[model samples]
Target chain A: MPKKNLNKLREKIPLLEDIGKDGRVWSDLCKQYGVENPDPPWRITLESTCEVLNEGACALPVLERRDEEDKLSEEIYKDVPYPERQLLALAHSMIKKGFFREEELGVQMEKVYKRLSAGT
Target chain B: MSKSDKHDHNAAPMVDEISDFEVLEVAVRELCIEKGLFTQEDHNEWTEYMHTLGPLPAGRLVAKAWLDPEYKQLCIDDPVKASLEVGIDWINSMPSKFGTPSDYCNPRILVDTPTLKHVVVCTLCSCYPRPILGQSPEWYRTPNYRRRMVRWPRQVLSEFGLQLPEDVEIRVADSNQKTRYVVMPIRPDGTEGWTEDQLTEIVTRDCLIGVALPRADRKADDKRPIHKAVHPYGH
Candidate 1:
């Protein structure tokens, strides 16, 4: 078989920042629908990023923290409403956007665990 | 009474007291609420909406379609509109008038034919048609099912006790986008003139997901080991 040239297919996709520079369309849609417009573009970006990345791979993301988070989400939130998983995903995304440190999450988890165990 | 004597034998023993995941859920929900991402009311309302959801409406949609050819065509052409016939207004049913944030308004009914079959999987995350079909099954959300269902659909279906002929094509609808899907399997035999309720009863959640076919005898999905929750949701 002859070698196929793949240079044309390797063009760089525009960065999310560049793509989100003009937010008029999205803001208009949000306004029309009575939904709050996502402030930091990261809200949509993180979700799309996960979708794009997952499209190519057969398995879930292998990052240790992500794996643990997903496992926990499945164990605890599987029977609950879908928003629980959504919130967990959003939290991770916020962490990615530097809203909070992973270490901070550990401390918060401990506090929350104590409160929950105490039946507060 | 001794310390051991106080323990009631009838009560279930506590397993892992407050797992890390439980802590993380609380931490994340609290942090998000504190950050003003969403209020506790919004979360509660969404949960309540979820409680109202189940596979019945989807099952009815399939049954109605099976009985009426025009409705079946309508289901193929405009599924969101078709959903209304079964009393599921995809847009206005939930707390969010626009639709559930995760499961957007766009829902497509993948109608199975004699020669073709359809199944759904969200390889990225479990993006199910929750507004209509309710919460996805625990197994469906697993990475193992997500991965294998897309790659080796035949093998996966066989494991679910669903084996089709070689000539019949198996299509795995990867719901990686905003558009969700519910499989409408071809109406099964042994019900030539059955009522809509009778037909709906046979179209179990598994049939809607295209895992198991609707049979006259089967009223529920195949029995699988259910992972008992440490603190199961009452609703």
Candidate 2:
């Protein structure tokens, strides 16, 4: 199947000017409903990506910094639900636990490619 | 060549090559199994669990709520608990005892009233209540839908053939975090004594997503063109 160019698709959609980098639109809506807004999804993705990459480079432990981060802002992330974030977090945890070396991923991926090509 | 044969020449290429994403997915799954994160049986069980999911359970939940007032309050107050009535245990239903790691446990049922309407969109990603509502529609996952639905909801809704009165308030619920949402539309008129089964038939997936409304005569969503997968699942 052909992959979609999401960046191109996003350009066609009309967005509101009030949708700030902090996700004010979501925050305002949550405020109207009397519920606390979770930190912007983009921010969560950004942080997760950074954490995962850092973990991959130098086997660091999972940062239990959610509590500190939550207290820093009124609109803070309460939970991580994004699939990419979940996948990255899992990889990060596994790396930290010494399950496998980050460098070995390329070799494993090649084996997987061979298996797929062989229709196994 | 014939016109048909000429048309086939312009069609998308059906390549047998595995993509990098496919290779990576297999590599990760295999590595996870090797590391004791999960077994092959667990992965197979999860696939089987996914096959059992559809819009029927979510529709039944709405139907039951519409038939019973207390149930409607339960739906609004504690949606995860209310999901139990439809046999969807968000936490323990999947392979993971806690919940599906990506979807998490929180589910909010947005109950619509005469003066208020609710529509859901995940501006960052498509965070759907898959346990009950099944796979999200392709349109829902599109960047166009994600960006436009949150900002120009009325315009987008109208494009989906749903138009509300000027006085009615439209709330666009952005499912950006753990809280997944399912819109429970108000029971339509002319179905005062309808059975739960009958009501459930009308509450289609589109209604649950708040793109359309249930009608006594309409038991299905408006027909739209489907993008056929090159390799459909379970083939």
Candidate 3:
């Protein structure tokens, strides 16, 4: 085996399944091929820091999520993704007010708001 | 355009306003009351159960490990086994017969060394060693923190105000599976012959979480931006 592949294999380790696969999770599945039990450097990373807004007005995707498109000024978000059904109301309001930017995306509000009620 | 027009008195938006979680919370509470699974009084008891938790017990656990080599081995050999030494029974000590619903029994005590430092995370979910260490921080529960920490550990650590030496191996512990971990940071100087209580005082929640170094003078985690909860669970 080449040195580079060995290094790559080592770096591509999996975490979670703690107690290391009933106590030991070796780096590569191959490494565990021989060793009775190996303790890979137990690395667990928790997820946070999600993007609140993207290029589009995409927001309100979940019930538990903090929503209220009215909190921010109009035109800040356009064609926001209805993370929840409540956002559909907000999305309609944004469209009725002509708040969506159609010139850039070449999408008219009447057409897109049609999808909002369809419940995608 | 006006406040009165927004209410939609004819077709009130209240129906859609209620979240799934909110609906579930109501339905579950009602069912429990109806079926007598647990009374309203029992719910309050559980709420009080949460009140008795903090970093005190976990801090003491780390202190004892620092003081005794035998105890330290117990921490390394069997964390749940060693939990007994600190008066925390991994099994048969929670509301559940087996263990707490959220934080299960599998516990790992990561012993930090002079050349190595340890931190923990649960990228998929905020699966923490809650029975022992209490709840996780809001920041630790973020998707960005989870996704970036393991891949770019040094970068994340720096964000947490931890700049480690290149030689010092930074071992990241993901508490994603059954097992949950707490860092047993290396005992620092200035406390030559300190008692367990004194040592525990310094090992605040931050040290166990691997965000702050345990120090004799410091007995608490530094305050940061705390995004207030709408209906935060409080005593």
Candidate 4:
């Protein structure tokens, strides 16, 4: 059973635009989490020199942020769920949490940057 | 060489015409139609539904979660409930009111951390989250990928251009049973002041499929080998 507020928001959000790439909050998510590594470097090799492969989009940024986040977590992660479930989990979380308020999503990012700068 | 070639040509070789499997598939389809188990229209409708699906809705789901904490919690707790926000009534959205025959309603959301990156592949069949994410990709339905990815995820992720540190955990969610899974990667840093629309653009099909993650500039999945069909079905 869902909570009343979450149920209400579910009725309002449109399907297509929900995941649009907004720049503000995402940077904060990165800093708040304190992720240090960005993605594995993309180096072309003999096996992949001419292969026209289609790994879905969003591969690069996700890889990039993953490193930074690892620095914050302090826990060993040998069993992360697969992509499908992970996407599903976040979507589920949104329904209950009501997204980062535009301001919070934006304002919080600065905190992340400041935290990193203090140490570096 | 000439004597051996002559002998090889004379031999009554194994059957080489239409494959037995192909014949059986045709037989079953025709028989189903003949028996009225379902009209040809029903199968065609299902195909049309398949053609209409993609990673769009699933991407939106992720973006919305990033913007709203409440919604994200809903997603993490009960994916079936969270899906309603995207207008996908898993139980009643498709031709089958009870959800697809293969992908059931039990969808579990997996959250990603800096030390954890996730990707999904079915080893037995192409079991996917059809209601929100649409149809599974062609490569995902192949036996070679399924057989290899679960047991050798790091090796496979490397092939997909994802190479994590040894300390990072690589959990592979196998949809071998009833529950289907999707990844919910934490938002990345490139965009500092993006709108909902801006965020959704980065969550591509491949990201939802677990091969990649969402970013600010990217609007598409990685380009891969495309094997054209002799007679491709267009919806």
- How high is each candidate's TM-score? 0.63, 0.57, 0.55, 0.54
- Pick by TM-score: which candidate is best? 1
Give the candidate order by descending lDDT: 1, 2, 3, 4
- Compared with the true structure, model 4 gives a TM-score of 0.54
The C-alpha lDDT values of all candidates are 0.65, 0.63, 0.54, 0.53
Q: What residue pairs clash in candidate 2, if any at all?
A: none
* Candidate achieving higher lDDT, 2 or 4: 2
Each prediction's number of clashing residue pairs: 0, 0, 20, 97
DockQ, per-model, please? 0.09, 0.10, 0.02, 0.01
Interface RMSD of each: 17.5, 16.4, 23.8, 27.1
Candidate 3 residue A114 Cα shift, in angstroms, is 41
Point out the higher-scoring one by lDDT: 1 or 4: 1
Clashing residue pairs in candidate 1, if any? none
| Residue A19, model 4: Cα distance from true site in angstroms | 43
Off by over 4 Å in 3: A1-120, B1-42, B226-235
**Candidate 4, chain A: TM-score against the reference:** 0.25
For candidate 1 chain B, which ten residues in a row score worst on lDDT? B226-235
Highest lDDT among the candidates is held by which one? 1
Please report, as a value between 0 and 1, the fraction of native contacts recovered by candidate 4: 0.00
* lDDT, candidate 1, B159-180, per-residue tens: 8999999999999999877899
